[model samples]
Target: MSRALLARNGRRALPLIYGGRRGTDTLSGVHLAARRFIVDMSYSAHFMDFKGSSIASSMKKLVVTKLSPNFREAVSTQTVAVPTPGDADLLVRNRFVGINASDINYSAGRYDPSVKPPFDAGFEGIGEVVGLGLSASSRYTVGDTVAYFGSGAFAEYTVVPAKEAVPVPAVKPEFLTLLVSGATAYIALKRLGDLAKGETVLVTAAAGGTGQFAVQFAKQAGCHVIGTCSTNEKAGFLKSIGCDRPINYTAEDLAKTLKKEYPQGIDVVYESVGGSVLELAVNSLANKGRLIVIGFISGYQSASGIPPFKGGTLPVKLLQKSASIRGFFLPHFLGDYREAMSSMIQMFAKGQLVCEVDFGDLAEEGKFVGLDAVFRAVDYMYAGRNLGKVVVEVAPPSVSNSKL
Candidate 1:
């Protein structure tokens, strides 16, 4: 029944318990104690499930073990001891973790300028609190389901400050319908775009994790939503979600279609795929239109770390139309989103927001499972195979029979 967990800045330390009794308080004695106690009781009782697992000294989580030094060769699975929570930290046992384009970019040494190699990977995930530091806030209990957007998310366990954790609705927290994708979609459109009813909105890479939400929200706002995807199947999915027009870029010339079909120009352009797509989207803006730049996914894999745009008059065209482009980064807007996220959770819980999970197997055989499949999940997303949010199942919650 003894569990050992000691950590500092996400690094593991010696356990307070070694054998079934108080630790001997020495390095050699600690190892000797574990061997003495673990002979009969299998470690199985501790780690079978995230919610049920007792705190342990070591754990398994994804890390930047070796890098091609970039996202293309981003991360690898490694087994490392779990760390003790700081006085103000809560140790969370992860259930489902999210994969964003930034995760890949970070693998390539992109995100923060000061982070070094062999660092922990992941930014967003959901799980239950299992352990807490003495000074940690009492607002949450051990086993309370929580969602967060911060570091060390790709692991089986993560330590976060109490204030950072967001309580999920009693329903399962789908990354697609909540924090990362759904919230980003809701915030970008409502706060940044200030979308007007019946306005023409164009969404690029429209079938993606965030774009799908953008499309639905824009439609719900009474805007004419036009989505761009690479395939007929994706286009069809877009249509099913209320997109007014689905342009299959694989079969249609985007520029020509925009010119011939909507000469009035697009009112709000949600541009994520930059480079050529951004250039085209910029040229397609209506008077007083607003283009919200979420991410330049097109340049994520590039060494230059910048998505290239058409060379000339990019500024002049925007000026001529009284149009403007503003960048939207979700992290900056997270603090103000509690009310909006609560509303979004209500929408999903009541069956208003679509809840779809991808079961198709690409690199794996049938379905994605555990941390190994995250790389494949990212590849599938890059290949445009996923129709909704790409969520990685880390560990399922444990249900105990003990009556409260």
Candidate 2:
């Protein structure tokens, strides 16, 4: 191997070996073993069986190639060359990918598709580090399980920055659902909500992904947690997760129930479901209360205008009560990701936080389909068909039991 192919960590660059037969290295010309080696720099990879056949080559396992607004007709699959790793990137062999409402939104074209067509979908997942770039090191090693927050998580393989990958503790795969969702909730509550010990918190959509984490996080923070859910069963689930009181919004007036339950008002509002729920939450704020707006799932598909707040709401309440409302996005807080992740990992290690998964059982039941089936899954999520974090399992190449 040429000296140029060896990075600072002393590992030879795998990019040169993985690149196609015709490689270009205008950067430098290095001779080794009486032959010229060219380096190719690409940033993507594919999942193949241990036998070296692409897992997505068949129609049933076709890889996703494009996305559009309509889930029913916008997605397609195609065969593309696997990309090479960058100097600071690690190639991960994905085991299980966690699905979130954000994935559904992007698939349905609810947000701008940052990457053009022919790109994979998904934002969070757990994988094993299979290959590393020249500069990759002790932070991640091959065979170590890890979790990350970034795109391309839907596919069989993905490349991410060394810093974004965190080693998975000795926990079951189910625990990852909490780490991915809980980390975001923990950061939002700690940083934006300024949650304090013994405070009271009201969490909207308290049965969903972030809401579930918010409820547990608030309880762990020594706060009295009140969770609002759409159904009595969900209310029971919330209470089982440490909620002090579960409000069934479908049957009772939220503001009236809050007034009856808290009486003195709540200290913080973890608002994930906006629209009517948001307005009700604002009306139930306590003196000096802070409202943390994490997501607007209620408005994900609103064709009509946002509903007007009942009567005239005023910022005067903020001035009179010293209250405030804030919004948070996890990606924007990358600077504090390490602290947030560390806290969550400790919580998981101690069983202080729990995760719920609505496993599709696609692989076991033989219901698994190609990339095109993603749209149907999104529809199921939007229709509230899934009870918890919804996931579609992609069978790994090494597993041959037919049931994933």
Best by TM-score: 1
Candidate 1 weakest lDDT stretch, 10 residues: 25-34
Every model's TM-score:
0.82, 0.76
Number of residue pairs clashing in candidate 2, backbone atoms closer than 3 angstroms, sequence gap of 3 or more or interchain: 1
lDDT (0-100) at residue 52 of candidate 1? 46
Best by lDDT: 1
* Superposition TM-score, candidate 2 onto the true structure: 0.76
Task: Please provide, for model 1 over 40-125, each residue's C-alpha lDDT reduced to its tens digit, 9 standing for 90 to 100.
Answer: 12212121122345556678877875444354466878888886566567778777877777677778776675777788888887
Clashing pairs in 1: 6-84, 7-83, 7-84, 58-81, 70-108, 71-108
Q: Under the 3 Å rule for N, CA and C atoms, how many clashes does model 1 have? A: 6
